[model samples]
Target: MEKIIKEAIYIQSPTYIGSYKEEDCIFLLKDISHLVTEKDDKEREEDINDGVHYSQMLPFEDTPSDEYMNIFYESLKENAMKVAVNTLRICEQILKNKGNDVILVSLARGGTPVGVLAKRYIKYKYNIDCPHYSLSIIRDKGLDENALIYIINKHKSTNIQFIDAWTGKGVVNHTLEKACREFNMKYEVDIDSGLAVLSDVGRCAKIYGTREDFLIPSACLNSTGSGLISRTFLDDKIISKHDFHGAKYYSNWKDIDCSNYFVDYISELFEKIDTKSGDKYTDINIKTAREDLIDIQKRFGVDSIRKIKAGIGETTRVLLRKIPYKILVSDINNPNVKYVLLLAKDRGIPIEIYKDMNYLCCALVTFAE
Candidate 1:
């Protein structure tokens, strides 16, 4: 399947729906906000379980409440330095390994903010203005081929590095590797699938800032935190072969959108923290994390590993989007999961104290019948 590389349909902040600056990152996604209808969360979850590809539909996102917003701000204030330090570490590693001319292709939504922060850090520290683009990569549908082709045509494939905020069950990591292989075969270009993340709670990625399952405030909100952009959507009915994967821009949410605030707050701390010291990647027991996940699946009777979302970020996502069966927390008093507790309580979802769990918290998605 030979694909003719065409100029990628890309957009920057303000011009599109995102609040990011023009230089922060380019979004390689077509805005299909007007073309697709939103589905109720529960209905969407049930449809996904019935073998409907999740990327085909967008879930309706509600405006977060004042209380929830408070939690997000509190979490950010408490963990700003932690996130800043990790971002620096990841950026430094990128320069050391991939060199100065690396192109950052952050997986859309979650990775957008992290990519923007990394790009800012590289310029601030090394004075290198590396190009950054946010593209969509659905789990089953694979990387947006058109987006990949567009980027490959513009930048050196070898210099491309994928970035994401954190790893959940490492599903995306495996998905990314598989997609890259198929894409390379089709396009005859080698794009490395190595994902650089701020938090590697799943202990999956080769490059990560920390293995601690702490709260990344970005996970606290939906599209509002991610440039008011809906999760990347792809439907054959709406998306064409020549079109990039689709996403809806939450234009109405601009007033309350925290996308820019999240990045700006963390980026501001870059100069204050000493990136040289205490910036070592602590080795985590990947085997143990994997074993723990398997044990969790068995104990919870979850048939699919995808249903068991581990780590603070993953758990937050389950609470925000999926029909959660229950939430497990290692410690109830830990400030890292304050937002989790709030969400669970608000939803009236059962919360269990799993003292021996590997992650600080984990969310079990209900098997929608």
Candidate 2:
């Protein structure tokens, strides 16, 4: 298919909702894959504790069980529209507050969908076609220089807002700030990484649609939830001096395509949102989330802060990819928590339930390194 936008914008492949021909000018956001595979949980804790980077390993590709999938679909049906509506409401607020002059830079892979939704939201609601670009931002490594250049030269935008799907432990939030600072120092471009997201369970970023970290339905599935694009990689073989970081499209997963379903489900909810008036969850903040991490670090006596991953998505990630040390859940009764618990039990990892967590019930991967 031809590219979605008329300009020189590029779309990557393997996006969750749809696929583009290999020769298409735009790249699909679906090519980034999970490095941590299902079996890694056995050694996840030790490796992370021992200074192994979490990005180096692949998470297990455990297909959700039939019952678990049913719950995901049920949640999609029950709350997808609500989430979408609220998301649109948030987008409307952001556009009014920030104006259509700023650039929308999505943190590639995860933030691409939200960026696209925000783009669509702007065009549909205000009749303004804002430019949207998904850029690669690897934790620790920094944002892709070539991608930033491509965007800056094309639109000449100085004011940019970075985006992601949701916040987890606020690691990426900090990572983005650091990356932007280095980029500005090197290239003389002033880009602020103050991020916007669908949810801010970590309470870190200034702009977001929701503060609750319950279950984003999108978190339950991988590429299928976003555009079928794999995660971005900055490795030598795939990237070069002039070219942007590249990824492969999982052209094979068309059989179980859920990309459009996820996009449209949220887009349709735009009508239900009041746009002008809605209850914003502004009271919840990131300080508590950070404090929780500090407590976990103190309790576990781990040296590195990165080892203490939290939230459902991060915890689910621990079970799927890392060799989990243990899982501290918010509620054993929560259905979403059940699968994580099952995965933990199956792996023989310990699990403890606690009800104190605000967005997520529990935390995971307490490294005793």
Candidate 3:
């Protein structure tokens, strides 16, 4: 296991076609799905509250159908330029604040796409070849300490910024903050947990591209759009101390990999954006995600806030990653959510129309064991 873990990463490797530039950062992950250790949707509710780490439960993976993928791509193609500009604008301020010290450590696999785009935009606009490292961070497991050690060993800067695609009830956001504090207290290294995301509907991030819960094409697919990597995984049996968390590199999916295309499509749009007036999103939906999530937890009787996922991106994740009891979509017919509807239907999951909700949709985890 140690041999495989060490050989899996390419810290000195250059950016290549099959793998990503993330080769510079340590990737302490490898595919362990063959263990067949994953659980179904019915096991989600009982095991979630058991307080075991979510990844340890191993939710079954279901790849979205071709129709579902096409909708997501079309949505991204239409809005790529605009979204790219907004992302660049948000990342610009972050880059300025961090200066020559910008070390973007995106929480893989969701944040990998955003991190790459930010890296590409910086190269496009400021001529800075910023280094982006995609690492694993499970909410309950905390940020990967070994990964941080690997980065510090290379860069030695506390100016690391965590990035994610969006905030869903801000659980991961909150988890990051807590993880940073714990890491600092344990190792005396200062790491900020304020994540940079493209969408911050939960208003948990100070550095965000937008607060709208829209369809992010990246959020639509599992790993095909995320560097052909599998969702991150961790377990004591497969992962040992002094090792980074694990994830599978889906090398076989290279033909369909949209990771590079997604970034380039957005990078081309950075030139068109007028950074002077890109403040188009809502001014921080500033209510605490904790409070909002409490209400959601009560309403859904999900028993735990972690089981109740809010926002369009997160709801899509629930359907994709876990067994969702029902999806609360404001409009199943909205083209933005068309893929979501298909995903739910494909899984035989129920969809409900809740027009007055704050987000595009919310997915409640099955309460039954």
The C-alpha TM-scores of every prediction are: 0.91, 0.78, 0.83
lDDT of 3 by residue, 66-173 (tens): 765776688788778657866876687788677855888888888888888887777777787777888788866778777776676666567788888888777688
**Whole-model lDDT, model 2:** 0.63
User: What are the Cα lDDT values of the candidates?
Assistant: 0.82, 0.63, 0.71
In model 3, which regions exceed 4 Å deviation? 1-18, 22-52, 62-64, 284-287, 320-323, 330-335, 338-356, 367-369
Model 3 lDDT, residue 211, Cα: 75
**Tens-digit lDDT string for candidate 2 (1-369):** 111112434423222323522221134232334331323455755676677654444334434456446645866776676567656756766776667776677776767667777777777778877767776777777777666766666566666677788886787898888988987877776777788887788888778777766566666666565555555555554344655665545556766656556666777767666644456545554457777777766766756666666777666655654566767776688675766777777789887665556645444444522
The C-alpha local distance difference test score for the whole of candidate 1 amounts to 0.82
Clashing residue pairs in all predictions, respectively, total 0, 46, 3
- Comparing 1 with 2 on TM-score, the higher-scoring candidate is 1
Question: If the candidates were sorted by their lDDT against the true structure, best first, what order would they fall in?
Answer: 1, 3, 2
Count: clashes, candidate 2: 46
| Residue 154, model 3, lDDT | 67
As for model 2, its CA RMSD to the true structure in angstroms is 5.9
Off by over 4 Å in 1: 1-17, 284-289, 320-323, 367-369
